[model samples]
Target: MAAYPENNRTWQIIHNARKGGYAVGGFCVYNAEGVLAVIKAAERCRSPAMIQFFPWTLHFHGPAFIKYAAEVARAASVPISIHLDHCLKPSDADLALECAFDSIMVDGSMYDEEGNIKYVKSVVDRAKDKGITVEAELGRMEGGEDGLPTIDLESVFTDPDMAADFVKKTGVHFLAPSFGNVHGPYPAGGAEKHWRLDRLEKIHAALGDATPLVLHGTHPLSDEMIRVGMARGMVKVNQNRNVRNGYHEYIAENCTKVELTTLQVEAVEAYSKGVERLMVEVFDSAGKA
Candidate 1:
């Protein structure tokens, strides 16, 4: 098995990724294709990155899938972090950590305040022993993910004060607090375009400079919004939907007379450029590796 990052803390890697002036890409993977696409992009850019999966998808791919992906990433010359995203159950959290994931995110923000704190603390204790970084959600996400239902502004907002307390109590290394972000693509002409940047800034201030904040469901937002998010302490930005859509679109546009393998390579190449563009232009992370 490959060794974990020398830091052994996801926050340290992301804090460096942020101070280095480039947002760390947390690409969500469902299968080998997703993992391959992300790693290739990171390597081509000569940057450090993260690959993660929603726990619901883990049921289909199995926990062994993370181990396989970790080994593949370990063989790469660039630094890579493997993470389990939005794990709701303790068993799932324990399994991912045992499988040697560098980070585990226990997303219990949908629960009430007491429930959220309790879950975060329990997972933190479990993950700490294994030298795995833990991330706890402070706010509820707007759109559905992992079969969870969508939440609106009234339902999904995170209390800045509560978020600070949650982080302190749980001793989580990273925080994924929702600020008008969703799980799926954003709606055209919706409030998502104008994300709650001020709210996010406030949350960052409450959490202080030490804890890195992750931005979830950032695909459909505009470049300006994404850049603002990075400046406001969003060290890690999740960008799975954009990658999937870009890859699929390229294959469909160019596969008229090509074989499946050719189309697959073409999609990979296209997605690589697409990811590179986002990292270099929007995230300003071209040479921060």
Candidate 2:
């Protein structure tokens, strides 16, 4: 068997969450403050965390920024890992593999099942040598996040049995299944009306505890619904706009009133507060460091 999903920082934190009956938040970040916010929240709550960056950051902030984020996160008292989210292009995956990230979400959802498996398997093969675990999205998620592409096609739910086969074939450490979960905010009905917990349950059952489930499309998901996903085996919950809104609100309100340094400090605090709440209340990861 491959030595992947075993020794890496991301794998270790997530594995601990799995064993401890809790979930770690995959907090997506774009800048230095975003990095600090996650570290602050994880340390304050004593929770394990994954600081995620989209592929845009790779080109915008560059690899040095990713290394800085990883350095900062790894230095925290709590268990924190740096992860590259939604590496859509194989080239981006290639670039991410050379960075300081502890994990990379290899998104092959745009491809056919066989193509996705082959693509993910290729990255997984290379990632093992770099000591970085990999996360693979099995089905296409509708809508999009800040840096991800918006797919006009309907959301494709992941097949439970196929998820297992994909995991086995690709040697992926984490699985983000699309089961009625869109990328952005839900339509008229909220996540409560759209999320298919039954499908998630089946996927979890198919993969068991060996492979962790990642909850995506969680912008407006209720705390109760989040808790329900955890019950069904979502060990890593991806939080993008969900936790960063507080930071945005603070920045918008205080940009003209406060000094740049002061604004950044307080803004990070606001972001951390949002992350800390989830760690303490919903994820049950606080004090699990």
Candidate 3:
């Protein structure tokens, strides 16, 4: 059995963080090195953190990787949750549950309101039986991450009324509503377009404090914006672009002289450093475990 079961502590981690005025960072990783980097950073900072795997990551690494991540989470000094991020299908959610993932994000935002709710409810019903937490997105986010398509920003910002109704009907533990955030990098000189706290606050007001909010595509937001968002109930922030960039930068800078074995070590160190900064500096989650 896992040290921290998804159904119980995973939900608590977000709720506690929100109540205590801190935001936990959800770091996405594709390989063992990336996993180690996130766990090591969380351990060093004593932060409650989450290691997330996207749909493509599961396809690339297989179900065995989830067990590997569970082992890492078990061994870590601080609390860690193994989460399946951006799962689009019920089968994918079932696979993650079968692999013992602590939490799963069911992304049915591509569909209309009724369709999204039905899809998310199906996953939630299954997950609840096994004690897993479900996160569902309400509005479509523009720009793609991990091969997903870019949606139009104008039509996709989440509505507060719709958000409240969605949560009530779906029984999702966390909500990822599109305020203005997108996946991957922001357009050049367009950082302002990526975050809208007024919209976020409205959602918070509608949903109230009990349901913790999640921020996806947070890599491009400034630290102040992140702080502002968290202050209004954003409990989990997903960061991938910076971590991947840091890992690649380190490997590119030193791969010529380093042995292949050393490359992995260097990548872990680089990724860990970036994750550490995000936890300790940006999210203010360090030492909150």
Candidate 4:
């Protein structure tokens, strides 16, 4: 059984943050260090945080790892939820459910509008039976994460009217719309175009505040952009590359001098600091728990 009932702790955390005009960080974890980092950061900062896994990460690490994540969430002082991020198929969602995820993102955005709605609704129906919260994507996100191919921006930008319809039709707990955000890191110089807050505002207007919005591709966005998105009803922001960057940078910087065991410890510490910085400084979820 899940430690916290599905849609109970996770939903309350997100809904409360949305109502309070703050955003929770959905930090993607691929290993024990990643999971420990997120949980420790949340506990230290007193923030409501989420530890998420991509389908590929789950494939690499296996379902048993999820139990460890669940155990950590159950033992944590602050609110934390384990979520499956960007599941492309219903079977993927089912696998996550089996692993006892509190929330799942059923991403059928590669399909046509009708097909996307149909697929997401099917997953939503199943998740609802388990009392699990479902988050579905309506707009395709550009840039690839976990070996997915990159998509063009023009083809994937979400339509406000369609977003409203999709939310009502699928009954998802949250919606991730493509409003000028992409997965993966921005170029070294930064993205030429800024996050289209105006477009996000339009979607907020169409969907109203009842439907909480989720923003993916959060790695390279500025603090101001994040604050603007949260103010416009974005309740969850997924950040992975930045955390990975921090981990890799730490290893690269310290690997030569440190013992192998100490190196691993340093990596976790660095990654935790990176994630904590986002939780406290960037996302503003610190102390919100």
> Which candidate should be chosen as best, given TM-score against the real structure?
2
Candidate 1 TM-score, true structure as reference = 0.90
Ten-residue region with minimum lDDT total, candidate 1: 1-10
Q: Candidate 2, residue 39: CA error in Å?
A: 0.4
lDDT of 4: 0.82
The C-alpha TM-scores of every prediction are 0.90, 0.97, 0.93, 0.91
Residue-by-residue lDDT tens digits, candidate 4, 16-64: 8887778899988888889988888888899999999898866887888
lDDT of 2 by residue, 1-289 (tens): 4365567889999989999999999998888998999999998888899999999999998999999998888789988999999999999999999999999999998899999999999999999899999999998898879868899888899999999999999999999998888888899888888888889999999999889999998878999989988999999999988888888999999999999999999999999999999999999999899
**Which residue segments of model 2 deviate by more than 4 Å?**
1-3
Worst 10 residues of 2 by lDDT: 1-10
State the displacement of the C-alpha of residue 99, model 4, in Å, after optimal TM-score superposition: 1.5
Clashes of each: 0, 0, 1, 0
lDDT of 1 by residue, 38-155 (tens): 7888888877788888886667878778788989988877788888888887777767767758898888866788888888888888777787888778877767765556666564
lDDT of 3 by residue, 138-240 (tens): 8988777885777764638899999999999999989998887778777775547657778989999999876789988775778877787788778999888
lDDT of 2 at 221: 90
Is 2 or 4 the stronger prediction by TM-score?
Answer: 2
lDDT of 3 at 86: 92
Error of 2 at 184 (Å): 0.4
